[model samples]
Target: MTEILDTAVDFRATMGRLATGVSVITTRSGSTPVGMTASAVSALSLAPLQLLVCIGNHLYTRTAIAEHGRFAVNVLGEDGEALARNFAASKADKFAGVETVDDHGVPVLKDAIAAVVCDVAEALPGGDHTIFVGAVRHCTHRVDCRPLLHFAGGFGALRTPRHA
Candidate 1:
């Protein structure tokens, strides 16, 4: 008998089956608005309030958060897929047509399912990415919007069945 680990693609596909929420990680430095879409956010605590966002070394956001010392996780809804795609792409005008406001003087897209403004408490090296642990400063949420969910590298809505 032999055991074999699946390839990265296959493993990634398998993990994609586990639905996860999508968020736009936003920050600003100097006079530029910097943001990127990420699904790697995870709530790490409650007693002291904490969460983590993974930033790739090559992305503009990696530099922005480090310089600005603060960030906001703008949780999107199912209808925000286009915005997510816009923020995730490599372009010079990601925010040109986006409707966002200065949050505590920092840019935050409007109508997010939820938004968490946090200060970068620490940044730790995590393999090929940097794990930014933040201490929440302020938070807000939409009254009745379901958050955007992602799975298998695609957008999805959980098949939530209504109770009888």
Candidate 2:
């Protein structure tokens, strides 16, 4: 048991070194919007226009996503680090002052660099999280914005490669 616990700690530290784009996964619980900052989102399939997001088993947002059967991925812009931190915190209302627009019954963050509305295609049980596969239903973006990124337990803006 001690060995397993140590491995979990080491694994988390190792994964933190991998930089990822920041996003807020939003869904409606009844008429109220629920959201959480997630970096575990990824594209799963192209033919069917599907994506996947992993939500912690203990989060209320995960329950809302499972029950609602729909969600929106609000990919943060370079100016969105504060918003990401806001959603990342456990709170009763992360959207309290955040402006949003409706996208297929899901709340889309108005200032996101990009957003995608999706219908929950499949929900799979992972070790400590639920893997939600979503079939995209809508998409929108702002071309002028640069994506927010996460690395080593902190948020940052993307720096384009000089060679490119």
Candidate with maximal lDDT: 2
Off by over 4 Å in 1: 1-3, 160-164
Report every candidate's CA lDDT: 0.88, 0.93
Instruction: Write candidate 1's Cα lDDT for 1-164 as tens digits.
Output: 15555887777777788888999999997888899999999998897999999999888899999999999999998788998899999998788988898887578889588999999999999877899999998888886567778977888765555659
Candidate 2 lDDT by residue in tens digits, 1-164? 35543587788877898999999999999999999999999999899999999999999999999999999999999899999999999888899989999989999999898999999999999999999999999988887577899998998887764553
Q: Give the C-alpha lDDT of model 1.
A: 0.88
How many residue pairs clash per model?
1, 0
For model 1, what is the error of residue 104's alpha carbon versus the real structure, in angstroms, after optimal superposition? 2.0
Displacement of the residue 134 alpha carbon in candidate 2, Å: 0.2
lDDT at 140, model 2: 87
Query: RMSD (Cα, Å) of candidate 2?
Result: 3.0
